[model samples]
Target: MSRDEQLRRAAYEEMEKHKDVVEKDPYRLHYHLMPTVGLLNDPNGFIQFKGTYHVYYQWMPFKTGHGAKFWGHYSSNDFVNWTHEEIALTPSEWYEKNGCYSGSAIEHDGKIYAYYTGNVKDEEGNRETYQCLAISEESLHFDKRGPVVHLPDGFTAHFRDPKVWEQDGAFFMVVGAQTRELKGAVALFRSDDLENWDYQGVLTGGGEGRLADFGYMFECPDLFPLGERDILIFSPQGIEASGMKYQNVYQAGYVAGQFDSATGTFEHGEFEELDRGFDFYAPQTTLDDKGRRILFAWMSVPDQNEQDHPTIEHKWLHTMTLPRELKLVDGKVRQVPLEEMEDLRVGPAIQVNVELNRETRVLKAVKGKAFEMEITDLSMTEGWFDLTVGDGIRFVYSSGEQTVTLERKSYVNGVVEKRQCSVKQLNSLRVFVDTSSIEVFVNEGEETFTARFYPSPNNDTVRFETSHQAVFTIRKWDLKHVNLK
Candidate 1:
């Protein structure tokens, strides 16, 4: 066997050893693609081909940790059930010696094309990136087309993660890149035959007047049309903490704007973060047949020094969040859980109107760690309102004079970690509570909080008692059994 085949075989063998723990129980994913084992990062090549949704991911098969990259495949008919496929692109080719990084997939005529980045390290430990392409005529067998577009002209080896889409009868691609001066930007390209690409100028960059600083570099840049405007999604590195922003080691988000293909520049407004939870990054979207824009994101930050994660002992480290429908609501993208999740609701349900701050406190059967609750503020109230849902888990939504602070308690041992931004409009709040997670969408995405929790099963009662009195409407739903096999 060839040396590349040896490496591919070694990686596959490692995945086999940790298969049990890696493919364990999946939680809270409504209708989206997820990993079966090990670590799943960037959402590579998402396409709907031959009446099936094919979603591939940046996979590391060696260990539960992020190792050499592999393109892991999955297919779904209704976005509900997924069938895992064999490894699509193995690192058994010289063009992709190190690994096959993140990219997008497309279907043309009858063939499915997978475009990705070939990442390699030279003898001197220098990184090399080749924009690679491959073809799968039958969706199972692949023929590597080798590197189609090499390092264009001015960028360094930091160039990677190509996202391709067809618009207005032509194909356009955007890739995350960095200048030789170490500035972060996205390079644009136009391709006709998927093999030949014409280089366009820098689409946009992160600088002083820019939305974000031109940090070390950007990765997994994705551009798509949303409503009347355009949305640019990417992961920016080296953003320092400035008060209430950039809390993670690396940030993945989007900029609302309009992309001008004529000048290759995107006139963008302030950057809006996609998620406020502990882990989310490298999101990619695909347009479905129904004309709805659906998106999926890696639920963990990249290159994090995760050592003692409980799941790591079992051999998997990450998962993807539920598939959310993306809509541009008032200049910001509003992500709502898909309607298909409603099918998971079984048994009798209950709704309540809780008068906050009263000793009326806990609602009877209205308690669960895994359920949905929508709270609408009838009047603007002051002080803090605590919604305790069994055990020590708390949903602290404080309308502190100016803004609302949404925090999750008893997560990871009483951390009381705060995700999502505060809602200034203290009029109402819509929340969804699951057995082990909480998702708060304030005023339809003006602000949102998605969190994971671990509370005992017996402690499933939800209590609502505020520090001050505030009239409210709470609607609850008892979810059906989730078959996470």
Candidate 2:
């Protein structure tokens, strides 16, 4: 047997030994992709091949920290039901002796081609990166073909996370990079075949003046066309906080702009954050067979609240956000829950209209840890309104101020932390609650807030209160469990 196969089997054996302990962690998500053991980081190599959707993530099966990562695999026919696959890539090659970092997947000439970063360090502790490729015909087992694209000029070893796609008869790859001068940027490359690549140039950098620019180093770059323009999605590190934005140590946002293929430059607009919440980063997308752009993000931010997570005692760490279908409307991307999710709704939705007037709260079968809720036709006279989910999280909106806030009990300092954004008006709200996470879609996806918090699993109460008169209609649906077997 190959050394890669040996490492993969040994990791699976470790997972088997910890299954009972990990399963006992109440924070384990019911319908999200999480590591069987150890840590799960960025969503890597996401694609839909031959009508089967495959999601490969960064996994370290030995502990709950960022270490040598293996690609954990999950497959789904519809986004609603998923089946876990074997470990995809193991750190067994000389170029990737340390780890196989984040990358993307594309189907080329009747085979599934996986492009990723090979992270290795020499004995003297120097870093080296290789833009590598592997191919599989049946999408079951892969044969490593080694590096297809070498490191180009001006960029350091931080250049990784290659997102590949085919456009106009040629393949284009966008990779996160940092120049030797320490400026963060996304570099562009072109290829007629996946084997040979030509570095075009840095598309943009992290200075305040350029398009798609902000941060010390960019990571996980994805560039694709949406609506009438193209969107470059990336996670930028080293951005200082601007009001309620950039609160996390890293930020995952995008620049909506036009890409000139002839000149290999992207002229874009401002950087808008994709999610306004505490626990979202490193998002990736793929166009499904149905022509809809579907996205999945690693549900935890790096170097923030990770140590405070309660799941580490059980030998697991994080999850992926529920699959969201993306649509570009009015020059902004809108994310709606996948329509296939309705397959998991248990019963008829319970609907009611609640009128608030300086009262504490009220509830009637409107609370659950795993359910969906929609509020619409909002009417308010004055003052702010709040809805408390579980014991540690709350959602507040003030129509008088045109602001919405998501507050959580800080795992960092055990105090309240909030992320606030202006919404112009409170048209409606759609919220999804799972075991340890909440995702809110505002105004038909004009804005979104995603968060993960560990409230007492037994406490599933949702309550609403207001300081003045207000009225809103609420519909709640209890979601059925999809066994992750």
Top candidate, metric lDDT: 2
TM-score versus the correct structure, for each prediction = 0.88, 0.98
Residue-level lDDT of model 1, residues 397-446, one tens digit each, is 56675444545553345667655455666555656665455666667656
lDDT of 2 by residue, 252-358 (tens): 99989999887888888888999998888999999887888889999888988687788999999999998888889989998888888777788899999898898
For residue 377, give model 2's deviation from the true position in Å. Answer: 1.3
Model 2 bad stretches (over 4 Å): 206-213
Cand. 2 TM to true fold: 0.98
Clashing pairs in 2: none
Clashing pairs in 1: 45-104, 45-105, 206-214, 367-462, 369-434, 369-435, 370-434, 370-435, 371-433, 377-428
| Model 1 stretches with alpha carbons more than 4 Å out | 1-16, 19-34, 206-212, 358-364, 367-370, 377-380, 388-393, 406-414, 426-437, 453-461, 478-485
Q: Output the lDDT of residue 239, model 2.
A: 89
